[model samples]
Target: MTASLQGQMMDMPLTVSALLAHAARFYGTVEIVSRRIEGDWHRYTYRECERRAKRLAQALIALGVEPGERVATFAWNGYRHLETYYGTAGFGAVCHTINPRLFPEQIAFIINHAQDRYVLFDITFAPLVDRLAPQCPQVRGWIALTDDAHRPDMRTPVSSYETLLAPHDGAFDWPRIDERSASYLCYTSGTTGHPKGALYTHRSTVLHAYGAALPNALGLSARDVVMPVVPMFHVNAWGIPHAGPLAGAKLVLPGKDLDGRSLYELMEAERVTFSAGVPTVWLGLLAYMKEAGARFSSLERMVIGGSACPPAMLRAFEDDYGVEVIHAWGMTEMSPLGSLVKLTGEERRRPPAEQRKLREKQGRAGFGVEMKIVGDGGRELPWDGVTFGDLHVRGPCVIDRYYRTDTSPLIDGWFPTGDVATLDADGCLHITDRSKDVIKSGGEWISSIDLENIAVAHPAVAEAACIALAHPRWNERPLLVVVKRPDAQVTREELLAFYADKVVKWWIPDDVVFVDELPHTATGKLQKLTLREQWRDHVPPSARGDADCPLTDVSTDLNADHAGCVPPSDRATRSPP
Candidate 1:
């Protein structure tokens, strides 16, 4: 074969610093509004952000931070956190973002594991820092993301963020570095074991920003005012810190106060045109709006991910309020921008019902991403939309291996997503359930996500989780656990009967249990593992020889004890029937 001729083009490496530079030069006047931890709104321009970021870089350098060293940040979504993102990575240091919501042990484990040189945190985490200071001995300094007046007194000595930057005159120039060098480090939620880190390169991060800002992906532009309700510590806030600035869109960072009222008021005040967050955040906003009989004044679209967006919530946004809802799905390893659900020209021409059905899926892969489903024995599955299998993906922005791990988790070049999913003929991705979370009953597969979505569609149901219970005949059967809306009553008989027409008879849950609340991970995903442990020994009515009990009697039994006929206290020492 003849050698192909290379095109003549500039070979400047893509870096995160370049993105901030472009924003400062072109979108200088664009506003970046943030809610401060001191209960006030802070606003600044991209030019000013660039100056402060440069000062931060100078401060880090003067403090003896070297290239590729880890600089950890424990902060909320705010201007200081944003400055840290640009300054640390811009100066060729790896910006390690630690989730504050993690357990104290996990937090310490992360800090020590990263061998973080310096720790920067918000004032809200002062007490946590004091508690963890003794555990993370390698940390050279702790800087509070606040001024001297707002700084809290802690057991450990801490420096002020603003005070540190005060010495630098913002004259430092960013050093050009290889784009393949590590720029950011984020750990998984560590639901199973110690959270492993995903180290991202500057090249991959810049590419991810381009893909995320694509018209078919997030569709970001300078005309849009964007707000990321997702914390900056989580997968780079799904890469909005990079993508939003790349698009030159005005940004609004809602710190700490993620409740419905605060979000609504902020959105209105800033005229936020676009936003992205997990479904739980939207649930609160929707509930608050319903109570206040409010409507959006400028908000136009929302991107929902982190977990499946319930059909009910989607309809409530689009039908009740005229806002478009985009369903998204991804993993930390993929830079968290894999698939987004947006209608195509042909899809838009379809019936409303058909469009809604298609929108319920996770949607198609963004540019640079390739996905497929595989079955047992490592065989690739077809995109027939009906055959669910293990989902795997590979792309330019995807992680090849986890940080500090010896073995590669990739199988034949694709990263197994640990999710059971399907791809339709048009290449749309449909997530059924996490591979570990899928239910197996009598050798048949059942999707707990489907059950939970349908349950939440009920007006009286606030949130739902379907967990597998030990069964004598089937080995495992599903039990629906629900939390009711305030002042809303739902009987087990009514809820069970409501599922009759919506799903296959066998797919329906065997029993219903109401609880005051369900557990969630730090990122707001359902804690199914915790739920399973809580209900591991639960006996469905069928297994208890009480399948024929009257519906009213079963309702009374469930109401009397949230654990069904047998309360959890009684089942502690008992075995499955």
Candidate 2:
């Protein structure tokens, strides 16, 4: 075999600092706007942000932060948090972003697990910091991400973010570090157990930024104005911090105020052209737009992920508001940019309804990402679009294993995504459901996502979550839980009837329950686990030989445990004689 020859080229390491430096030097005048915790809008240029970030790097050094050390940040998406991202990682230390939305115990567990040296936070989280200080003894110091005057008076001695950077003259140089060294640390949401960290390296982070900014993925450019409504603490805000700067797009960060009104105002005030966030955030924005009868002036595109976007929401954005909806899918372990739903020239030539259907899928895998679906016994499934299987992916940006864990989660060099999905002949990825969330009835599978999407398509339904309820004859059946629009009326019979022709007769939900709102995780995903626990013993009206109940009645008979009682209606059609 011939020996592989290496090309003679410059061996400069790809580092996070390089992204910011390039932006500052070339896109110096590009604006980086942020809504501050002080209830005011702050604006700066990439050049100035780079200078302050350099000063922050020097400040960390003075505080005895060494290379490979972990500096934690509990902050919202803003300029200071952006500075923390580059400053800590640029100095060869790991920037650990902690989600403040998690419970106090979970936050303390993560801080201790990471053994973070210093904790920096926005002023909005001062109260939370005080509660967590005693629990996280490894956190050496707490730095408030605010100026001297607005610094919170906490029980523990805290330093001001501005004060720390004031002494440094922004003359420090970013040291050359190995590209494989750890750059960032982010933990999972920990819905099942304690959250595990997914540590990112400099090489992988840089490659992810490049791939995400590609023409097919985010398609970011210097002319675009980008706002990431996704929290900075969540998967690095879907990697916008790095990709936006790499594309030289102007950034607008909405700090701490993610409500519909605040986000709409910010988007209008700044003339944001492109934005990214989970479906829940966009739902709130859509609701507000309907109430105020407003339309977007400058917004052009929106990237929706974190959960399956209801078909109705997709139509609302593209058809009603004239904004392109880019449905995306990924996990925390994949550097969170696996696949994006964008139509091709061939696909776009079809009718609008057909194009919408293509966009309904998760789209094709992004560059550098390879994906496949496997059935039972590890057998690879064919891309026929009808068969569903476990979705797995492998890529340069994907994690080899979790941080601090000895065992690798990869199967045959590919990471199992824990999603049941299908791929069409054209290689479009369609996520059907989470592996744990798929409902099995009489040895047949039903996609909860499909049911939920159809349920939310009803005009009166605001949000809907379909969960598997314990059943006697069928093993388990889907029970629809819905939240209705304010002042809108919808009955249980009406909703169940609405699903008549949309899906298979057997796939329709057995019963419906109205709730004030469905519970969501910190990252804006529907909490199906919580819903299952809440309705573990719920008896469907079908099983009780009763007609469909009222939607306004929020009561359920938890003591009805008759699993052997098969309704005559179900037996006549579905049961074997």
In model 1, the clashing pairs are none
Which candidate leads in lDDT? 1
Q: With candidate 2 superimposed using the best TM-score fit, by how many Å does residue 34's alpha carbon deviate from the native?
A: 0.8
How far in Å is the alpha carbon of 576 misplaced in model 2?
24
Give the lowest summed-lDDT range of ten residues in model 1: 568-577
Q: How far is candidate 1 from the true structure (C-alpha RMSD, Å)?
A: 6.5
> By TM-score, how accurate is candidate 1?
0.95
lDDT of 1 at 141: 98
**What's the distance in Å from true for residue 370, model 1?**
0.7
lDDT of 2 by residue, 1-577 (tens): 9999999999999999999999999999999999999998899999999999999999999999999999999999999999999999998999999999998999999999999999999988889998999998888899999999999888988999999999999997889999999999999999889998999999999999998998889999999999999999999999999999999999999998988999999999999999999988998999999999999999999899989888999999999999999999998998888999888888889998899998888999988899888875677877877667889999988999999999999999999989989888888999998989998765467789999999999999999999998877567788999999999999988998998788755677889999998988878889999999998889976567565532113224222222123344333222111
What's the count of clashing pairs in each model shown? 0, 0
How would you encode candidate 1's per-residue C-alpha lDDT over 238-341 as one tens digit per residue?
99999999999999999999999999999999999999999999999999999999999999999999999999999999999999998999989998899999
Poorly placed runs, candidate 1 (over 4 Å): 548-577
TM-scores of all models? 0.95, 0.95
